[model samples]
Target: MFTGIVEELGTVEAVEPLADGGRLTISGPVVTADARHGDSIAVNGVCLTVVEVGEGRFTVDVVSETLRRSSLKGVAPGEKVNLERAMALGDRLGGHIVQGHVDGTAVLRATEPDGLTRFEIPERLSRYLVEKGSITVDGVSLTVVEAGDREFSVALIPTTKQLTTLGVRQPGDEVNIEVDVLAKHLERLARPQLDGLARGE
Candidate 1:
């Protein structure tokens, strides 16, 4: 339900370890202004439910599975994270339809002076990308400029450079990535027919 639009750069205050998961406390003035228990917030592209909210701070739990999958695995006390609340019913979709569900992680390969950044993606994920397609990286939605077998590029304007975590990210850093849901859906829908065609049916 998120738009992949980062509302603010939240700071991780604490991380409490648990048997099955970890509790994260983060401070985000914009997102916590009207936060409530059970509210969903996108933290670095992962949709997490709010366990508590107060004094410009909020808490969320990340299970072991999420830790193993996304770049949020080793988030530290002072790490800056992208934060965005779930979109309201009537709000405009400033970005694409972002579920705040991280599919996997991509390593930042390079960034140009003009903010043209490229990430080295896995072939499994790259298959879903197309020129000008939408992709969410660390919770910020961006359009693909050059789609390759195992890499892609996106232009981040000055605004995005100053607002989101991507601005400060350097080459070699890892980031959570979510491919367009629509593309994944289409592939699934066509899989059966495509399989039949391969069989000469």
Candidate 2:
């Protein structure tokens, strides 16, 4: 698991195609300082395993499923990506609990000079979002300012605008989004009751 707090802005060094998936070589000095194979790292909110570590860089294999679910499908060399090491036990949860599991991708709809940004999300994911709820976007945890049927907005601070990939993201860009895990759990736990109510029982 992760805290959605970005530790570094890493660069994609290379991408090698594989039969069933692909391999990515990313240069993230901080995350790889003590990294070893099988470690979990959140790269742009996707929990990818370390395949190998070498000289301030590491390799990860992205399967077809991850590519289909995230914005990493067509990631290229030299692109910047948010990087975070997996949180250790008893560590402070600076941000919300992020599983690094991208529920889906959201599109950057618009942006304002003051960091009030809007994103158009998949309609099905809207139910989990609420005002003030936590959402992970491209590995950065942010609070939802407004929620809509197909869109939502968040207020980004100056530090966020200069530290993560969201800072340089332009309109029309697609980014990974993870709705709060707690919300999903609650919904699952209440589904049976909700179904009974729907039947007027």
Candidate 3:
């Protein structure tokens, strides 16, 4: 339910380990201004629920599953993270539809600097990328300029360079990626029924 527009770069204040999960306290002025308990906030593309809130900071519990799926498991104090609150019912959809659910992580393979920067995509998420398709990297929505079997590329303009985390990422860093939901649904609908064919009985 996020627009994939990063409101601000938040910093992790603290991290506490639980038995099967962990609690994270992040400080973001813009997103925490009106925050309340149970509110949803997208932290680096992961939609996490606020368990507690105070001046410019909020707490969220990162369960074992989320940790396994995202780079948040490696997050530590002082790390800068992209932050966005859920889009309001009547708010403008500045970016494409973003669920704030990280499907998987992609490694930064390479970067090419032109008028618009192009990032060499990762193999795991390349199949979902296409020319002009929408992909969320580290919580920022971007369009693919070219795609290949192992790597794809996206054009990043100056504005995108200054506002989001993708601007400063290096090769080898991990980025959270959420493919277009419509593509996923279409793929599911088009999948052949192998089980039915195998069981002719």
Candidate 4:
């Protein structure tokens, strides 16, 4: 698991298309310092395993499923991506629990000068959002300030803007999103109880 704390902003060095998927070569000096084969790295919020590691660069294979669920499908060379290594057992949970599993993608709908950003999410994912809830956008964890039917807003501090890819995002740009996993677990656990209540059991 990851904490959604971006360790570095990496650049996509190359992309190679395959019959079933694609291979990505990314350059992240910090994250690749101790990298090895089979190590997992969160690339723009999608967890990808390292297939090979070289000087300040690592390669990973992106399967078709991951592409369908993330904005990585449209990624190309020269793109900046958020990078984070899996959290160590005793490391501080600086942000929140980020599984690095992109649930879906959200489109940046608006942005304000005062650090407020709004994103248009799918209706199905909206239920998982709450005021002050945690959400990972492009691998950076943020809290929701406003939750709507198909949109949510988050306030970004200057530090966040300067350290991550979010600072350069524009309206209509698609970002990978992962809602709070706790919310999903709670919802699943409550379903059976709700069903019993509905039947007057």
- Overall lDDT per candidate, in order of appearance: 0.95, 0.95, 0.85, 0.95
Tens digit per residue, CA lDDT, model 3, 33-116: 998899999999999999999999999999999999998999999999999999889999988999988988877777765544
lDDT for predicted candidate 4 compared with the true structure? 0.95
Task: Give me the runs in candidate 3 sitting further than 4 Å from their true place.
Answer: 115-124, 193-201
RMSD of 2: 0.8
Candidate 1 per-residue C-alpha lDDT over 110-157 given as tens digits, one digit per residue, 9 for 90 to 100: 987765799999999999999999999999999999999999999998
Model 2 worst lDDT window (10 residues): 107-116
Count backbone overlaps in model 2. 0
Pairs clashing within candidate 1: none
Number of the candidate with higher TM-score, 1 or 3: 1
Model 1 lDDT on a 0 to 1 scale: 0.95
Error of 2 at 102 (Å): 0.8
Stretches off by above 4 angstroms in model 4 are 199-201
TM-scores of the models, in the order given: 0.98, 0.98, 0.91, 0.97
